[model samples]
Target: MAHSAFNRKESRGAHQRLDEGCTERDDVNFLKHTLAFYNPEGAPHLEYSDVKITKSAPAKRVYGGEATAQDKQNKEKANADDMKHVKMEVMRYNPETDDAPHFVTYDVPYDEQTSLLDALGYIKDNLAPDLSYRWSCRMAICGSCGMMVNRVPKLACKTFMRDYPNGVRIEALGNFPVERDLVVDMTHFIESLEAIKPYILGNDRKPSEGPNKQTPAQMAKYHQFSGCINCGLCYAACPQFGLNPEFIGPAAITLAQRYNTDSRDHGAKERMPQLNSENGVWSCTFVGYCSEVCPKHVDPAAAIQQGKAASAQDFVIAMLKPR
Candidate 1:
């Protein structure tokens, strides 16, 4: 990679060292790419692939390229009085090219409305085209942009850049495999959610039957727990989940409690067996960080604590019953 890049003779992006003077893009000679072929017991061989251009003639890019022009514009605009600067340290990784994750700092322009997601977008658009991350529903409702800013789990959309006076160091959410950059593999979290049967179960009643109404007191029992958006922030916040990926996790356990406490849901008896398992609610030590990081005030830690009490009482009742 070093040899290939050094051979470019250009003074920008990958071609860091320029023994030759800077010049506009010369597509005539530079249109081809270098390819390396590995050999078993000898030095690798180099080959070149010519790029075929069938369209209109290529335009000469002065002072780097269009990327450099846009970057210069952004930098100049950032110098205005109303604009402010936010230093963003974003973690980057690519399984194909990178051996491990590494942090890359970017100076971004921000105002009162700029968020962590916005900073990332600016970096991707104007600075680095290869930057990878996840985001949707710019509002916090979609829960797709969860990440760790300064070692604390948060939703990038909801977290404003102005709050971090010093700067923000962003990484992928904890306790999950990095899919790419800020994106994580939430398959385990999805499986855990599915294991608890998140939906109302065995409700085969016909529409003719009256509504299974619940009083306000009954609604209050599970209302707070029902607020979970399945953002996985609680799972990231949980130290136990970090240690054991096999654990059902805070969001799933809290979901179990949500349905178990609901007057409409009759799946509690079915859910208890899973909750009583080795990788169930008992894994939680009530660290309460799950509740602290919950974007919707789901309070998963409280639900898990309640589940422990329920588990104990169920055990006692089962032991005393005449069998």
Candidate 2:
């Protein structure tokens, strides 16, 4: 701008100051000042005119320099006023160094769009280098950011910071051993899922039995159960699992039912032993908190109830038919 201007007033050899309220610097305020024009013999002169002359409605002449300074101050104040800060109370744990887990609080600024996961990231990046947690596919698809927020199970990325006007309390998912700060050991969970035989049972087809057919209605029977992302929020919310870790848990039972209700699967018989065991579907007292906390809305409580009915039917069939 200084290079292309006719002759910037600040750099002019001999320029007459005909305008008022011109400061030492920022007098122009990026093209808001009265423009300079060249007179005869190429000598640059400041155009004598009211600042209001270029305004949408012309009436007043004001101090350009003072107005520019005041406007900058007001903008700075407004930007500061718009932002709000919250305290993130994050759980910290180190098995080798600490006897037990503890909480660390950090003051982080946030707006309505700020998520709890983002707040944790901010703290980890700026405040504490040793902070540890887990997150991936921040859109909530990967189910890796599972944690206990304010004592409730949720995905950090999906949980917003602004929602907690009074701040937030975070911990690892319940019913699982904490591996680190927010990461819980999922070995038991993985084994539980494997125990259910969560795949379709083969019918011993030589080639292909025309790829088992099913209409939309048949698919709809277990469609809701198939949406499980295996976030394990349901397991965290289940009081049954907390009471008895041996319980197969909601996610595993729901997965079992997902295949059991499928028209293309014959693995229900194989899964029935696990589902009918003392630690299987029978362990769930149907508190329904598991369904309430499931991020994907895979209703494990409903699935367990369905499994009970199936188990009862199996009992009746065994009684009716002599082995």
Candidate 3:
């Protein structure tokens, strides 16, 4: 797997190759699964299999264009005719009224371009005013509207209703206690984030001691991990956190890795105790689901795995040097 990844000289998704420096997707050579056969004595044999493209064909994205009035009307009418009403099963709970959480169905008027957040807003405005869910900024930046949509962790604002034309089940994020309808308790997540100390701890340098400047190379080391918005979608998708709530799940660990990699940060030693703990990098089984579900593409799985290697090296060095 390592060999295959190294040889793939194209940038795609979260995998960016500095040597290649190409942003365009290379569909011809890499749009397929790479199967590696293990060998005890020799280099592993590699094979490629075609990816099954079921629903839509691959196409380049065209940005910045508004649909014409006629096009908008046509699409709206088509959507209304095709899907008059969409049955949304939203999880509802209230400590005052209900003892247990239950799914409350709502038949909402479907629109083609409308997002899942929009549908929820419609229900809140017209149908059920008492229904509770956390949302702010309506954009994907806030990361507050993250929920289990069709059993996958995604931002409701980013997920369009047209994608799931049939229907979709909405619930609170997994691996968390439900505070109320579609609102999971984020106390644990917040605490974990705080423990990581997700800030630049410079070398005791004050603001008066000139600027803590960094070159492009220094920034690139931790830039990707810094994009995390603390959505907790990674926690929802992490099996390790599900099995052990005490585990310092993906996002926090990723943030730790982020700061550790930064050239300006000097708090890696302080954070090492948590990273090398039993409930830290060691607990992660590397399911890679955390990376798959991250809207920001923070790639927490990669960060944890890298932390494991670094921690192991540090442990071996400490043992040898009696430090």
Candidate 4:
């Protein structure tokens, strides 16, 4: 109800919130990166929810002393429910006016149900009408909302805001030039997607025969690779692409894999020459980041690795057969 009370600049803030019930430390690295500017040395406050936090110092452990298991669980749950909300300071960029990006803090009343995408939408609707970012589907399927949520490539729609208890910092996808606030040049990702010839390749005979017969079992082989939504999240997450822009990246590899595994396709033999070349499938070092950041679960790393195996097999059989 009191949005103004939470809104303030970084230099001043009289109200302080305490967090409690740290269920996991897995996100410590991510939090450290997101809130680094505000709490340079260490985390300024603890992150928890209304279900968490304590009124006073928690009872200390005594050697060999233990509370009933149910009692301990109830206490832990209570601590988690008492957590408080905090502010998120986000970096904003304007290509038309500002030479560089600047930080703008927002007092986002935290709730366990809040997501980074939800927060961004709230800010855009309430705090800043001019703020720019891309989002198609509120779900991760669209992949249009992929960006750096605290320096990690992720889909804004999928990243939960409450996960970052301290605060959050959002940025455009890394390794690409920003067009404006959160949009980056997707030309490279598009071109690479095109490079692998994403469309199905067929001979004149196949069309004459009508729909090429493909069994359900056959479709199963390549189903995973075919799930690609042309999202460039894999490319942004790929260090290989960062090192060598010419590298085809994961999405393209998956594209190629999609066609190659099709039962009726013969182009796998033909595409082998192109895929085996220096900047083709061979360039992938299998860093596995592409798979990690994929919002669609289209594992480009596995596709590329599988492509290499297919290529290797082709080479072996070609050499063994008649000259």
Candidate 5:
């Protein structure tokens, strides 16, 4: 995997090569699945197979800043007067009043740029004032509006209404008990995060001792994992977490790796107990869905895999040492 990544001379998605500035997709030579045959004694044999383009042709995706003021005003005006409406079947539950969770549909006037969060806001303000959900910072940064949209975990602020113009179903994040309408009890997830010791540990140095600095190379090692916003979307997408709630799960493990990989941190040994346990990195099946749903692209699956390798090496070294 490392060889293939290093050989690829382009910047695309999460894989960026410093030697090669962002280059156009090489569809002719590189649009294929690479198959590596392992050799225990020597370098692996590499082969490539043609990728079957199923739905659409590959194209360059451009990410831009927010819409201009005039554009926003035009869109808002169009949405307010537009007769077109989208049906939103939101999951409703009130433990204090309801026996079980139920779905309530609402028709929301929307424009091409209206997001799921916007529709929910309209429903709250207009149709159903009693409706309950969590949201803040209508942008994706807050990570408070995570929910299951059409059975797929997504940030409500990031999902556009146009993507599901016909209609859409919204529910609380999966792999968690519902606390109320579109709100899940996050106690377990938070506990798991705490178990990994998300912060720097055993740093006894004081301000008088001087600052702890890190090089760009050292920062690059764990920078990707540090982008996690604790949205819990990775937990929702993790089938392992769904099956066994005891598993440490993806985000927490990734956060552990973030600190473990920091050159300035000495917490790897302290955190090894959790990372080497039965419910640790060994529990992951590498489904990779966690990475798919991650808004920050933290790639928790890769972090867990790296943790497994480190744990295995540690076990061998421990076994070889005399008591």
Candidate 6:
């Protein structure tokens, strides 16, 4: 549970250092604030290119190699050659052959540019052909390659292996029934999304009727909530979804918000109870992990929060009206 204390001075999306040593020891109580970063450049400087220029007196040109660019490239090549490989212990399960699942270790060639997806590809190509996992659109757009790498939910295409070189542990995504090795049952999540009436009920007239008019501001209001790819990473990260299976999770709730907030849709009042029901928005405790694990930047937690507020406002407005 590596975490950092919250600093109000920094923006919500700004980078903050994680005091891993202090957090593991449980020395002090500090609130953890998770934020999203789009690229590796947003990570710590050492995680990527380590070359830095510092000013001591007059900003001297300090090179670890000669003035020639090829010299430095050769030095980096030698540095990479000296690095060692590591073992990746992945959970293996086969319903047809094996009675139970077990961890299988595979020594993968490691490098700074290698990703967890790369290691898995190597295993499937050279080491083991029977290794089972779900993956599509390796660029993270399909959101199918999500898994628990070292007990943390992450996208295989985005999570680099260099950050964790010493033996790594890969497993299926949490809070779901294990279907096979590195694959989990997604039927529950799919059903939950369907339960929320995910599509827009934009029909108030017949097919020959005029189009539904909508303002630009109204489109902008729900635009941010429409980027969900239903990765199920948020459901795995959410404790509420773990406790109650009918919580609707984040993806569906965000989808509901997408429709409910749209000016062209006339079902906001009809969708109010579904979003505010006992097992719906009220079940979420604002864990905020939904937004944190979202790969598409669709902050479902914020959508659920706004849903609750909308529900409360509707309730109050109804109570104030005369009979």
lDDT of each: 0.84, 0.83, 0.85, 0.74, 0.86, 0.78
Flag regions of model 6 displaced more than 4 Å: 1-84, 97-99, 204-214, 317-323
TM-score of each: 0.74, 0.73, 0.73, 0.67, 0.74, 0.68
Give the distance in Å from residue 113's predicted Cα in candidate 1 to where it truly belongs: 0.9
Which run of 10 residues does model 1 get worst, by summed lDDT? 8-17
- Residue-by-residue lDDT tens digits, candidate 2, 1-39: 122475565444224343754444443343344456667
Q: Write the per-residue lDDT of candidate 6 for residues 1-323, one digit (tens) a residue.
A: 21243334333222334543322432122232333334545542111122344666876777666367566456655654676677999999999988988999997776888889978986886679899888888888898988998887888888888888778999999888899999999998888787767766756666678776778888999999988888888988999988987777888888888988877677777677777788878899998987987778889999999988888898899899999
lDDT of 3 by residue, 82-160 (tens): 7657889999999788899899889877767788998898788667988888889888899999999989999999998
Off by over 4 Å in 1: 1-82
Residues forming the 10-long window of minimal summed lDDT in candidate 2: 22-31
State which candidate, 1 or 2, has the greater lDDT: 1
How high a TM-score does candidate 3 get? 0.73
The sequence of per-residue lDDT tens digits that candidate 4 reaches over residues 123-151 is 77556878788888887777788888778
Residue-wise lDDT of candidate 5 within 1-323, one digit each (tens)? 33555344332333444456636555655566665555676675666777677897689664566556567557655757865788899999999999999999988888777889989988886678888888899888988999999999999999999888789999999999999999999898999899988888877889997888889999999999999989999999999999999998998899999999988788889889999999999999999999999998789989999999999998999999999
Q: What ordering of candidates by lDDT runs from best to worst?
A: 5, 3, 1, 2, 6, 4
Q: How does residue 77 of candidate 1 score in lDDT?
A: 66
Candidate 3: worst-modelled 10 consecutive residues by lDDT:
6-15
